[model samples]
Target: MITLLLSSHAQRIWGERIAVAVPPGTLSFLTAEEALAAEGPSAADIAFMTREVTGKSSPSHPTPELRGFDAVVEKSPNLKWLQIHPAGAERPIYRQLRARGVKVTTASGATAVTVAHSTLGAVIAINRRFPLLADAQRRHAWEPRLAERSPRDLAGQCAVIVGMGPIGRNIASLLGMLGMRTIGVRRTAEPVEPCERVVAYEQLHEVLPQADWLILCCPASPVTRGIANAAAFAAMPEGAHLINVARGEIAVEQDVIAVLQSGKLAGAYLDVFEREPLDAASPLWDLPNVLVSPHTASHSLGQNEAIFGIFLDNLARFRAGQALRNDVDNLG
Candidate 1:
């Protein structure tokens, strides 16, 4: 019989459907709380994680509930697979689990559309100078000074997009509608849709000077951690803008601060930071050329339901010994 470990909330919400998918007497269940309290390693063969325990957590800070979940998974002596929620495999715990030979599946493409749209929104907001206009309105001033600080046209400009995953690809497609040229960057250099050309990650600097805008849409990983450092900023064309919708680890915050201070970059729209709740005295708050967000780029409706469907489908495939849709390797 297949033994499954899950969160208490998952059992309450989808226990019946899970049971319906599997034949009676063919599977047994153990909740995360039960696993943690077990005498020895909870002999669970599969662990199903949802947003309940995975949501609202970051690398710098994990919620108590999230820590507990990680502890349970780590202690599972027989855990062969983990059906985790959307894009959560970036966690260090998951890397450890993968090193231990446990299979990890995710609902990666579930939030692609939502995040892609949000990223496009950030690009547009910065392109049209919404932050500057908002500041002008705050003073009740009619400062549409065309000669000074005039917004440039997006058409005929270049965009260098890093990490061309589902979200990145979608962002490129949207950018194309605005008549902007796109260059995609990823592990592989193969050409993709809506991009003039694709380059390997190592060639990042080769194309930085050509970018009018640089967008970070990659998942946080060993290769991507601190990928955007001071040297990267130095390579970009003067007055280039930046948009980071990915995790904060992808860019060095201190280096980002330095570049903004030096006016090496025209402006930056950041949704993630190296530290969560960004310290009160952070220079990012006072940077006139930066737009900061609370890392809510993918906060859209119906995402949870979509991820749930991917998990359920994968569960049925697991029972049938079929290939899972979003089975993962090393998360990134």
Candidate 2:
């Protein structure tokens, strides 16, 4: 019997569906609280984790809790694999499992469509000044067009996407169809279609100054943490737009805010934050040149169902003892 530990209530529902889809796999459901209460380190062959399972209460960055993270790894002595619900996995819990010789995986490709749409929406919302219009429309006021910040077209713009992974590639394709010049940044300079040129990670600095729209789509790994700092923001043209749909920690929050405040960059569209529920007093809430979303770029009514579809497909691979998809071999 393969004992699978499910920590979130929502995950339990998804897991039940996956369990039924898999071949004769047994599951054990427990909340994060209950899982902690159980004594003697409950053993499991596999563990499915939500952000809650890793001690992160917010939708932003993962909480820094080595103890709780270590506790989870310690709880599953016989664990073979640990799967996270979200795409980014630079969390302490993921690292802990890596130290424990367990395999890790993420729902990386699953949320691409939702994330791509949201990121594109952010770009449009900020460029079109939707926030101001939304407030005015709420009051039943139909004001004439506001003065443009800079009459720019998303098409004919030079766009640099910082990752060539599933989500990044999807965004590149979307932008390409809109007649934008696409440049890709990948670990290797592989030939990714829909991109005019592929640059290596080392060439990020070179490409930044040329981008009219800079989109961050890289994975949240150790090497990528805080990769986009003041230098990156400063490298853009004066009125260039910035969009981040990747991990929040990938960019330094203070630097981004400082640049936005100083008008160095025309505007920023962010769906993820270094900290979530963004403090009630966060200046970003009122920043006119920025669009702040509650890390909800990857959420939709059918998200769970879509995730289950991928999970069920992988479960079939597991049953056949074949390689699984989106498997994260290294947590760090």
* Candidate with maximal lDDT: 1
- Which residue runs does candidate 1 get wrong by more than 4 Å? 330-332
Clashes of 1: 0
Please provide, for model 1 over 139-252, each residue's C-alpha lDDT reduced to its tens digit, 9 standing for 90 to 100: 897877387578788889999999888888998999899999999999989999879999999999999999999899887778889999999988998888888988898999
Error of 2 at 21 (Å): 2.9
Q: Which stretches of candidate 2 lie over 4 Å from their true place?
A: 8-16, 22-35, 51-56, 59-73, 135-150, 330-332
Q: Over the full model, what C-alpha lDDT does candidate 1 score relative to the true structure? A: 0.85
Candidate 1 lDDT at 209 equals: 93
lDDT of each: 0.85, 0.74
Clashes of each: 0, 0
Please give the RMSD to the true structure for each candidate, in Å.
1.9, 3.4
lDDT of 2 by residue, 42-115 (tens): 66677666544444456444454424544755677888776667776666666778777777778878888888
Candidate 1, residue 282: how far the Cα is off, in Å = 0.8
Residue 13 of candidate 1: its Cα lDDT?
84
For model 2, state the Cα shift of residue 126 in Å: 1.9
